[model samples]
Target chain A: MSTVLEMLSTPLFQRALLAALVVGISAPVVGTFLVQRRLSLLGDGIGHVALTGVALGWLVGAATGAARADAYAIPGAVLASIAGAVVIEAVRARGRTSGDLALALLFYGGIAGGVVLIGLAGGTNANLMSYLFGSLATVSSADLVATLVMSGVILAVGVGLRSALFAVSQDEEFARSTGLPVTVLNIAVAVVAALTVTVSMRVVGLLLVSALMIVPVAASQLVARSFRQTMTIAMVIGGLACVGGLLVTFTVDLAPGALIVVIAIAIYAGTAALRPLWHRAARPASTSEEARADATDDPATHRAR
Target chain B: MQLADPGSDPDPLHLHGVSVAVAGTTLLEDVSLRVHPGEAVALLGANGSGKSTLIRAALGQVPVVSGDAKLYDVSTRHHAARVAWPRIGYVPQRLSAASGVPATVLEVVLTGLLGRNRWWLRRADREQALAALEELGVADLAHRPFGILSGGQAQRVVIARALVRRPDLLILDEPLAGVDLLTQFSFAALLGRLHAEGRTIVVVLHELGPFAELLDRAVVLRAGRVIHDGDLPRDHAHPHGAHDHLHVEHALPSEPPTQRSLP
Candidate 1:
């Protein structure tokens, strides 16, 4: 606890922790929508695509002899991720049964492309590797600022479009029938999801970013009764996981990305295991609200099983 | 501002030579039909007879290969087609019981009012949703998870969703499918109320079932073409009886109407 307090007092550690907290909050906000729509792995796909963007930024920096390529990396990744999102949308829109197959192909193909591009960029710098495994120590002030701004934009959009996103995600044809511009909203969701994936890669790394996006949401779904409640709980759980993982990393020699993911997975497992206990505790109270919650809760648990 | 007032002139929906083809196989071909204002028209056919596709085509959900689908004289293909959807409320078939997300009955119905113009639900919208649910007698189930509801209860909620918009045109695809018989009568009663409000309704049904009384006309389709587009026979039509369902096969014309392109 003394060591944690000492580290928290440092400006660099504070910035890195703040960045992780931002990711913890915002990634799950967007993730709840994706998971509800059964697109949980879309974050991983976008993360892989973002790697290519990071590689391209490095190549551009090398050619221009810029002081740093990291400045261009996030934006490049955002663009590349959006492109990959559009491709996934297009494949699904084709109404083919093989669309899932196409997405899987794109998912692995993106990672392979990223590796080749990173190799061609000819940078043996540990900075590139840090993007894959995540290093809180490497989060510069500039990267922190960019992460905050980008994450803020994503959060605003996610919160603002919450209703429309829920409506469209739950029922596309019905949303369209109500004049909700289902196609545009879907594309917007894809874009926002891409943004979340790209920014979260800084905290969780490209390889494990999706775990950051999905795990807390899965845990929240087990504990919360309503859509709104689920989102709030997921955000809280994500923040806790981030803080807990960061503190553990400080005490031990471990990769921040891997440790964060492990922490999130543990939270999910813990939530699932404790769900019956939660119900049992609530059963004694037996209030109408509890009864209603119990009524709603069973089908969801059954479906999940 | 006012409840729907039906007129004979501009039909709420008109499918003129609409042909929907998916992957080189025509789902609906040369389907020309019209639902006049305040009319409760039912599209009847066996599965794969294009009843659902025809309704989908009219809503511009499916592509019209060689003809036009118009909602109240506005071409569904027009750029402004989206603006006209608010006037048309649509209810999909009842969802499967195993759907993972447990949206509240109110939440499901509230989505009916969500559109490009209104992304957020106001108190007025909430009241409107409540009123619609109340109208369908599912107001008590407003806070209940929709997935937990019985088939009949769920269908009522779906109907409530459609009625929330107070739409001039209501299109329901298989509203009675998987619904209990007792609930089917209740749904018929609900449709009767909508029809009395002078709303134009186009519903797809495998059999007339309890919906017989509310149906002003029945359009029967066979192999993607309309076989019967007028009155149902007296013997086959149900008149608000406790039991009202005719075997569609026995009721359909034995010779079958000659398949021809709509001019």
Candidate 2:
């Protein structure tokens, strides 16, 4: 507790904590929509594209000698992601392309582009490993601000895209006939997904950012009854994973991103395995007891079960 | 002003050489029909006769292979197709779809008010949705989750979604199938009322015998082509006691026409 409090007071540590909390919330909210739309792969693909942004950022910033690192690194990455989004849309409009194919194409293309660019800009004083695989041990205040701002943008867009997303996923034709802008809705979702993936890089490595966005929600789904319930559970689980990962990382001097992902997987496994067992363990002794209670006219217990 | 075409009041929907082929098979071929305002036309066809495809085409929801489907005199390709939708309400056959979707009757109905013209809906949207529910006599079920509603109840709610738009045309696809006789009569009465108000209604029905008298005209299809298009065959086609369904208290016995019956 004392160590945790001390870490909380330090500006860098505080920044990491804020970033973790915000990312935890934003990931699950956006993730729920993706899962509902059966676009979980799309999230993964976009998260992968976001990696190109990170690589692009480092390449540009390192070449510029860190004079305008923030502007070069962050904005360049975001713009690249937006461009990737546009290209994805354009490809989809051309022929027998699907969202899934488009996503995979952009993600792989981003990765290839990013790696080539990073390799071409070779001389790096900063550790490329840290950006590629994340080092929460030294998350900066600026990185935290970037995460928060991006998460906020993702959240705002998610809220606006709620109905549009729902309509498109469930019934595209009805949505179109009812005047819902299906194309615009799809583009908006892609943009937000890209933003979310871009911002979450500090807590989850470029290779693993999608897992951070997807795993908690997937794990939370084991015990959740409804989409909304799943979203809430995902957020809670994600935040807990972040907090626990941070504590474990700072204490044991481990890589926070990798540790957090392991914890997320563990949570997913535990929830999936234990929820049914817990329900079975908690059930009443006999069906006769439930029958007796119902006979007596007290309906609340029956309702509770 | 935009959902309705300004150039011509010819009919709500005019399809000419409208054919749609999915993958390789021709689903709808050279189908031409006109649905005039204040008219109630029953679309009669056997299964795979392009009944569903026809309904979808009229709403500009399906791709036309060769010809044009004009929704209020505007081709589906026109930018006004988006604007044309709000003025025409479409209730698809199945409300039992999206069984996992969590929405209340009121929430689903409120969706009708959404169109490209409006960014967001206000209290007026809810009010209109509510009024549509009231008109359909399903306002009491507004708070219930749509997934949990009875088929009859859900069908009414879906109809309300179309009716709430207050469009120039109302298109329903196989609405009466699986619905109770009482509910069917009530629904048909609502359509009768809409037709009386000068709104065009085109309904796709597999079983047309029960409500034969309710509709003013019908276009029967045989393998993606219109075989018959005229006033109902009123001259003792069945005399099967099906037409007097509203006066009876029992379920309306309905079986498809012999030629169109499933093999």
Best-performing candidate as measured by DockQ? 1
lDDT tens digits, residue span A1-305, model 1: 89878988988888888988999989998888888787888888888888888887777777777787555677778889999988887777677598989988888887777677767767754656777777677788888988898889878878788888888877777888888878888888888888888878888888888888889999988867667777888899888888788878887878777888899899999889999898788456444543343321222322222
lDDT per residue for candidate 2 within A260-283, as digits (tens), equals 889999998988789878667766
- Fold similarity of candidate 1's chain A to the true chain A, as a TM-score: 0.90
What is candidate 1's CA lDDT for residue B239?
A: 25
lDDT: worst 10-residue window of model 1 chain A: A296-305
The reply for model 2, stretches above 4 Å from the true place, is A56-80, A83-117, A123-133, A215-244, A252-254, A258-305, B1-10, B21-26, B93-101, B123-154, B177-186, B233-263
Provide the TM-score for each candidate, comma-separated. Answer: 0.90, 0.76
Query: RMSDs, each prediction?
Result: 7.3, 7.3
- Model 1 lDDT per residue over B23-94, tens place: 889999898998888889988877788988898888888877989999878887665335477788998864
Candidate 2 lDDT by residue in tens digits, B6-32: 245767888888998877789889999
